[model samples]
Target: MSGVEFNRRLESIPVYPAAESYGEDEGLIKLASNETPWGPPPAVIGAIQGQLETLNRYPDPAKSVLRRRIAERSDVPISKVVVGNGSCEILLAAGDALLEPGAEIVYAWPSFSMYPHLAAQSGARAVEVPLANGVHDLEAMAREVNAATRLVLVCNPNNPTATAVGIDEIDAFVASLPRHVAVILDEAYVEFNLLQDPGESIDLLSKHSNLVVLRTFSKVYGLCGLRAGYALGTEEFRLAVDRVRQP
Candidate 1:
């Protein structure tokens, strides 16, 4: 007898290791997640408290307020921004809009583990370009692109390793890719890198119509509980992702 069939990729995908809870007396320290040691600032707490009255109400369908604020901060038009639960949701939207069977999603390994899972769930092939000394091998990744490639994910200051590719390096990589393939610059950890040398990928978006920059309040802003994040890209690309984003 045959078992019920589902997407085959689901069987091989790695599960995210969730942090286990501990009793107050256990003295067990949870380190599996990257949660901040401190709580959000007083202003943020007060702002959240002010929204208590609206707890029963559904959030705005368009996420207009947050979208406008993100647009102002990123200096992009508001129409180009799509706010979501977190940047991960934006990545999922990218997968839904761009990936399918026989399609490809190229990214660097030793990076975000979610990239492969996202690609697989979308029924797309995941082409991992091995990192060069823990940083993204942009040149090699560019070489992996072909007509069937739909999306490329570049996690700047890449996860786990905390290494980043410079602006010039990425600018050249995006320029080398075909127009049909869209690129997502995962900048979730960008705030940490901005202190010494702020990257200019966002500034270069005007020239590269295929690039999308993702950011989140989960890290530096200490808003992981709120799950606020957004994407900055061309209006067309944002709309494409929005088509898959739940209203």
Candidate 2:
């Protein structure tokens, strides 16, 4: 081991529980991870194959083409879109950019495990509000937000539990929060749980300045191997997160 000291915050972080593997002879089926078992659609395959000719060239650092498409799809301005290797990268970027020593981030307990891990890496406190009956207790979470709280993560259709909070509930929660705090709506599974209207988050962005909605192509779009995802928010939030992202 190196002589350099490690960050104290890492002490509480558990090793990430990765999917288990099996030997060829064992032939064990792997189902622990949340992944699409099927192959990518023909269009996605075609688009990827189309990029093979330019494999030697580096992609546009700005990712303008993909960002433009995500902007249009999310109904957000191009300036407010920031793409990433995956939504997880966007989440990690938020932690790096928004949190500071002694800062706190609030999110539902038993939700995505990464929320707390990201907060810890930033030397921030992970304020976990226990879920009420397998759903986010948004009211409790809002109450936990004090001056030290810098960020909140809401995983709609929360992971592990497979429950979601609706648009109306989200609207009230944002309105109740202090304007200084930023909230990230991790809609990694939104496509599977859309309501009567699918653009609610996009529409809500116009009203909530501190909100960031993250989406990933790994889910319904079936592009897990491509590692594409994006975040849509106000120009201020997007730019701040982008500054921490790897170019």
Candidate 3:
């Protein structure tokens, strides 16, 4: 092998363990990836077919049409929306923009596997608070924050555990954080959560300028293969994430 040097930071990051795949004949319903039980509706399939003619052309780098649609749906200004290949990409972009070697990122232990990787890739310290009975101990997570903390990731209706904190709990948590700390409220499984109001978090954006809400089509919309996701935040935050995102 040619002697090539990789980023030393990558040395500490464990490879993300992807789920196992099965052949069509295996008759398996793979729930491990959190994919929908059914595929997208006919309308969605038709929309994809309509775009087949444009296969040779590149998609709009600005993602103008898609961003406008997401903005209209979320009832937020287009400037506040940043679309990515997936919600995971937005998470990485946030780390790239807000984290450095000395910064710290706080999140609960046994949460999304991606959390620890984010900290490692950014060369930021990972402050993992132990879960209180399989649920994110938000209080414990908040207590871990200090001057060096730059980002806090909260995965509501948390993966692997299906448990969620109420909106009031989230509101109070964000309110408690310092203005310098950016909170990434990952709502990947929000649609599956019947306990909390889905739209309540969108309202929190206007109240906290440092909060960035992430949503994805992969979960509820059955668009995991398409990799469409977006973030809702203040214009400043949107621009910062966009700057670091791939063109």
Best by lDDT: 3
Model-by-model lDDT, in order? Answer: 0.86, 0.86, 0.90
**Which is the winner by lDDT between candidate 2 and candidate 3?**
3
Error of 1 at 120 (Å): 1.2
Candidate 3: regions farther than 4 A off: 18-29
Model 3: per-residue lDDT, tens digit, 116-192? Answer: 88888988999989889999999999899999999999999898788899999999999999999999999999987
Per-residue lDDT value at 203 in model 1: 87
lDDT of 1: 0.86
Deviation from native of the Cα of residue 76 in model 2, angstroms:
1.9
Count of clashing residue pairs in every prediction: 0, 0, 0
TM-score for each candidate, following the candidate numbering: 0.93, 0.94, 0.94
For model 1, state the Cα shift of residue 123 in Å: 1.1
Error of 2 at 239 (Å): 1.4
Global Cα RMSD, each model: 2.3, 1.7, 1.9
- Rank ordering of all candidates by TM-score, starting from the highest: 3, 2, 1
Q: Per-residue lDDT of 111-136 in model 1, one digit per residue for the tens?
A: 88788887778888889999998888
Q: Which residue pairs collide, candidate 3? A: none
